[model samples]
Target: MAAGGRASGRPAKKKGPNKGTGGQKRRSLEGKGATPPAHMRHWFKDKSRSERIAREDRGGTTGAGGRAPARRRSEDAPEYIGGRNPVLEALSAGVPATALYVAQRIDNDDRVRDAIKVATERGVALLEVTRDKLDRLTEGAVHQGVALQIPAYEYAHPDELIDLAHDAGEPPLIVALDGVTDPRNLGAIARSATAFGAHGLLIPSRRSAGVTGGAWKTSAGTLANLRVARAANLTAALREYREAGLFVVGLDGEGTTEIADVQLFTEPLVIVVGSEGRGLSRLVREHCDVVARIPMQAAAESLNAGVAAGVTLYEVARHRRR
Candidate 1:
C-alpha cells in the first residue's frame, strides 16, 4: 500500500473528450434530410425548381377546368387575416374563423383584447403561439400580435346572380371583372356593388383575384352581404348572360359609348371591367354587347379596376334611380 492509495492502481487515466464529441456526429441531422412529412410542410413550401417553372408556365392561374388546381391553397386553404386592424375588423364583421392566434405574451392592447373577445365570443379556437409561428402563418408580414384563419369564400354559381334578381322581382345587376388581380380592388368593387344595389359579383375562376381576406376587409365586410360568383371563362360567362337576356356591358377607355350616354344601365346587366392597363381583352371585348367608356378630363388618365367599377356602378345606380 503506497500512501493510502490502491496498491493495484496505475497512473490515473486522463479524460479524453468525455467519450462523445459534443453532438459532432449528430450534425448530419441538422442538414437537409429526406423530404419532410407532408403534414409538416407548409402549403407551397419546398417547391422544386421544376415545379416553380411549371407553376409559372400555368401563369399562376387555374386552367380550363374552371377551378383552381387541387393542390393550390387558393382553392382549398385557410385564409389568413393578418395585422391587428384587419383581424379585429374581420372578427367584428362576423367573418367565420377557424382559429385565432395571438403571439404568446403579446401586449394585451385594445385591438388584441378586442380580437380575443370577439374570437372567444364567436367560439373561434384561440391559440397562443410563438412569434415564429405567427410569422410563418403570415408569411413574414406584419401581424401586429394577432391573426385569424378563415375558410375560403364559397362562390355562387354565375346563374345565381340572375336568379337572385328574379327572386327579388327586379332586373339583374351584376358586376363582372375581366382580369383584375388585385384583391383590394375586388373588395372595393364589392363595396361599391353592394352600395349601388348590384345583385352579385362575377370573377373568372382563373386570371382574376378571388374573394380573399384582403378583399373581404377592403369591402368593409360588404362581401358577406353580396353573392360572389366565379366564371370558368369570363367571355363565355358574358355570352351566357346575353343568352339569358341580360345586357353585357364592358368598361374600356376607348369604348364607343360613354357611361353617361349608355342606354342599358337600367336593363338587366352585367358590367365587365377590364384591367387598368389593357382596358379589355380582345375576346372579352368581342363578347360585350356594348363597350362603354368613362369620360375623363385627361385622355391619358386611367382608373384602376376598383375606381372604374365604382364609377360604372354609380352611373348604373343613377340610371336605376331615374
Candidate 2:
C-alpha cells in the first residue's frame, strides 16, 4: 500500500525534460501566428516622421527609432474635402479646387458622372486612388468614396462682396460671420445666406473660419452659389457695410430686442452671428448698428452659431417677402 501511494499516477510521466511551465508552451504557440503585443506591433508599423511628431504632440509613444520623418515645407499636399454635397456645391460655385480624387472601384452613377464632368470642365485634376489611400488622405473622415483637393480658399475682398451685392441688384442682404472657426458652421451659414436670397457672405480674414473642404461639404453646395468676401478687419467690414448704406445687425444673447421684434427688411441689411463660445469680439460688437437676440425658451442659453445665423436669415427673408 505504501509503495502504491509513493509511486502513484503511472510514474508521473517522467517529467518530460523539465520543459518550463504551461505559460511557455502557450507563448510558443502564440509565437506561431499570434498578433504582437500592442506595444510591439505599434513599434514595427511604418509612420512618417511628421506623423510621429504629431503622435508625440498627442503624448503617444513614438517607438524605438524616436526619429521623426523629415518635414517637407513645400505646398504640394492636396487639400482634401469629403462628402458629396459639399464637393458638388464647390464645383457649382466655381471655387478653384485643385483636383478630385475618386475611389478606383466606386460606382459610376449619374451623379458621380456629372460631378466628374463638372470637375473636368473646371480643369480640376482627377485622380483615381485605392480606397485605402483615399481613407488615409481623409484621415478616416466620412468621405463617401469621393474627395476634392482645392487650393486654399480665395476670399473676395469686403468691397468686392458689397460690389457683388450691388451688381446682383442694390440693397443686398449680406450675411457675415464673426469669429466662427468651425468650417461646418461657416458652410451652414453660407447655405442659409443663399436660401434667404442674400447676395454674399462676409468673413473676417483673422480669427474666423475660412472656406475649406469641410465647410464646402456642410454648405451642401451653397458655397458655390454665394459670394464669400474676406475682410482684413471685421469691425472695419461692418463699418464698410454701414458706409454702404446697409444696416448691420449683430446677433447676441444679451440684446435688448429680439430679432423678430426688429424691422430688418425695409433696408439693405447685413446680419452677423458671433462665435460659438464667445459671442462677438468687443470691437465687432461696437460696430453693429443694432445688437438683437433670437427669442428662445429661458432654458436655452444660446443657439448654435449656424442655427442662429439661419434664424436671422429667415427673419430677413420673411420681411423681404412681406
Candidate 3:
C-alpha cells in the first residue's frame, strides 16, 4: 500500500455507474413546468416591428421596376389605429375595422365605451388583451388601452369598373395608371377621378401602387366613394378597353397634342398616367389611342402622375360638360 493510495481494505470502493454530476442535466433538459403563453412571457417582445412599420412608411423598399417588394401589411397585414379617440372616430366613420382590442381592466371612458359599442354594432371582433399585448399590436403607439385593426383594402376588377359606369347609365371614365408606384399619387388621382365623375381607377397588377393606408389618408376619404380596379397586363387591358369602345389616352410631357384638344374626350375614356420619372412606357404609349400633354405656360420639365392626372381629368370634365 503506498502512502496516499487507497488501501486494499475493501476492494478499493467498487466503481459504480457514472451519475453525471448529481443528475443535474435532467433538470436542465426539463422545461421549467408547462411553458407560459407568448402574451404572458416577459421576454417575448415584438421584434423589429417598429422597423417594419418604418419601412412601410418609406414606401416599402421598392424592388425591380420600382414596385414594392412584398410590402406585406398593406396587402394583407392588418393596420391598427391606436388611441381611444382615433379608434372611436375610425369606428364612427365606418372605417371597416376587423377587430377591436381592449386592454384588460381598462378605464371605461366615453371614447373607449363608444368604440366598443360601435364595434359591437358592426359585428367587429372584440378581444380583451393585456396592456402589453395591446402595446405590441399598436407598435407602442399611445394606445390608451385600445386598438382597432383595419383589414387590407379590396380592389375591384377592370370590367367591374366598366360595369359600374354602365350600371349607373353613364359612360365609363376610368383613370389607368401606367407606372405610378406612389400610393399618395394613386390616392390623389383617385380623388380627382372620383370628383371629375370618373367611374373608377385602373392600375397594373405589378409595378403599380395599390390601395393602402397612405392612399386612404391622402385621398381625404375620397377612396371610400371611388372604386379602384387592377389589371395584370396594363397594355393588354388598355387594348381590351379600346375594343370595348373606350378611348385610351396617354398623358405625357412630350406629346404634340394637348389634353384639351384630344378628340376622344366625349368617348368612354381611360386616362393613362405614367410614372413621374419616365412618363409612359413604349408599349403603353403605342397602345394608347391618343397621346396628349397638359398645356404648360413655362418650360417645365414634367408633372407628377397626380398633378398631370388632375389637370387632365379637369380638362376631360370641362370638355364633356361642354
Name the best candidate (by TM-score): 1
lDDT of 3 by residue, 1-322 (tens): 7567766564656565467654545665555688888777655645456666787776587679978885444367866777777677667767778899999999998888898899999999999999989876766667899888878778797899999989999878999998898988997897798789999999898988888655664565577678888888999988999999998899999887887679988789998998887999999999988889888898778897899999998888988898
lDDT of 3: 0.83
Off by over 4 Å in 3: 1-74, 80-93, 99-148
Q: Rank the candidates by TM-score, best first.
A: 1, 2, 3
Per-residue lDDT tens digits for candidate 1, residues 7-53, read 76677666655435554456644757698776677654556556777
Name the 10 consecutive residues with the lowest summed lDDT in model 1. 16-25
lDDT pick, better of 1 and 3: 1
Residue runs of model 2 more than 4 Å from their true location after superposition: 1-78, 84-95, 107-114, 117-124
lDDT by residue for model 2 over 18-68, one digit each (tens)? 465544465654545777765576555544566766775554654568855
What are the Cα lDDT values of the candidates? 0.86, 0.78, 0.83
Candidate 1, residue 77: lDDT: 77
Taking all chains together, each candidate's TM-score versus the true structure is: 0.76, 0.71, 0.67
Better of 2 and 3 by lDDT: 3
